[model samples]
Target: MTRLHTLFLIGMLALLISTPTFALTGRVINQTLNRPEPDIEVSYILHETGDVTVVRDTTDSKGQFILDVPSDPGAEPPPMLFARYNGIDYPGNPAPAGDTVDIPVFETTESDTAISLSSHHILLDAQAGTATYIFIVHNHGDHTYLTGGDHGHGLEIPLPDGVTDFIRAPQGVHLHGTLLVDPRPIIPGNSQTFFTFSIPPSNRIAQRITYPTAGMDLLVQPTDTPVSTTVLRDLGDVTLGTNVFRRFGAEQLAPGTQIDIALSSPETASNLQTPIWIAATSMVVVAILVIYMRTLKTVPNRRTILLEQIADLDERYESGELSEDDYKNRRNALKAEVIDLSDSN
Candidate 1:
């Protein structure tokens, strides 16, 4: 072959070989504004090895970036690519070359306007001199609400005076005297808090609160389970029931609104079987199973769900429920499943 022709053929072969490496293109935008977000950092994380390959460019003025993810033939499965913005990561769908990926990001803002009480379940243990309060706080707004210090998202709840101990607070919340303060930012979604504390024995228990939003579903346990019997002093807008009193509607609780629940031990109140407590005990199992089922939809889903399950299992094992052998076995099984699923994909 002629020298000129040989060089041209070699150049063409190199171009063909490099084409697949530059297949993925991405764009980042402000979800609420539908505008390009420039100068935001992005990353490509490998699914298998946890190896991260960062791109050279942040989103340009047009909120666009291109990544050259070359497939490793030596790796059992082609490494999946993930696009990360800020701290949240998003998986990339496998697509043909030149396909553009759009990533939407929202700017975090402090706002209490969208805060609402989705559910409030109160359980009073008169025998133990304690009360358990479960509150599901929801943020319906587009921005996040930060808690703690001045100018924070305020959710001030007043406890009955003379409480001895603050037993538990959810991961993000902190106990301050008789009040609960969430130190983490409440993302634009539902976050739950379980507050348990000791209180002085009294015929009546009152809950007072001033929140930024209106409406809440209040559930007070009646003469059922191990908890003591509690009667609503004033029905107000609540609908009475035998085992639990439920109130759900657009009943706006004005600031300093107090809900008084009177406690009385009825003759029929009895301790239920221990098996009935399975609902709470099975949370970890249920969470793992749900994640497994959700991941069955796709390989990427499986990878993410399995990783989450592994983390949850570690936490559960550390809490002393799972033995070392059991934890290692389960973790290994999940890792193998992840590998098999990735290989299949």
Candidate 2:
């Protein structure tokens, strides 16, 4: 053979050896419209360190892409791939090398169906003059419910006449007087809120919540879901079945109908009247004392002192005494003590 021909064969072999063997192949589809989505951006994210690497090509006309991602030996957990659609990221299953991944996307539209209440739990704390209500709101429609503008007013929940101190609302929801309004849209699926308010002590506390639509499933205590630790005591007319306290309505509620729940807290029970700030400070002090006592019993040393300082730093950061950058730097320095102690041992 000629020398030029031999050289060409050697270069071809080098090119073949350098090319990566594994690849990630995937297709993006609009599940709501039942069609392939073309020219959409897809991302591959490393699981452990949250490092993101983008694919070069968008989906083709057939909504398919093949990405030649070289396998990384340093990546602790295998990376994952997901597609972004309509300002939301839909994640796919853990994609190893040479796997076909398909991502489904949905379109958001305005929904007309009434929101359903899947669960309602009332915890009456007579001792603290507070009654905490938890409502599990579910949207069983194809579209999301937008609260403002032409979408109409959001869900209305009536509070007790003397109710005060609305404790919490869902993240995007706005609280005005007794009404809990969603400032943003309530997306499809299930969303919940734990709202506590102060009420006068009474033998029978009448709690009424008005909904925009009718169908709802009321439960005194969650059956399968482990939500809160507060338990309802002094059951009046409500019947208990097994471990669950459920009240299933036979008919869809009329639009204006008010669902009333009666709760009775024992006379011996005291209301939770202490301010939150006072309670939080007391808990922090108790935790610090307990940790200090334990450290003293365990034998004081540099390692123990470093751990205590780390805990104190975390508490100060949470209480707004330390800035984020300072807290992170100090905490990282303290964690280095772990390595020193390990070496000494």
Per-residue lDDT for 39-114 in model 1, tens only?
A: 7666553333333333444778988877666654343223344444544444545344657777656555556677
Each model's RMSD to truth, in Å? Answer: 11.0, 15.1
Pairs of colliding residues, candidate 2:
127-270, 127-271, 128-270, 128-271, 128-272, 129-271
Candidate 2, 120-158: lDDT as tens digits: 555444334445565555666655555453224565566
What's each prediction's clash count? 0, 6
Candidate 2: residue 33 lDDT (0-100): 78
C-alpha local distance difference test of each model: 0.52, 0.52
Measured on C-alpha atoms, candidate 1 has an lDDT of 0.52
Worst-scoring 10-residue span by lDDT in model 1: 225-234
Q: List candidate 2 segments past 4 Å from native.
A: 1-25, 39-83, 89-102, 112-114, 123-129, 148-156, 200-257, 261-345
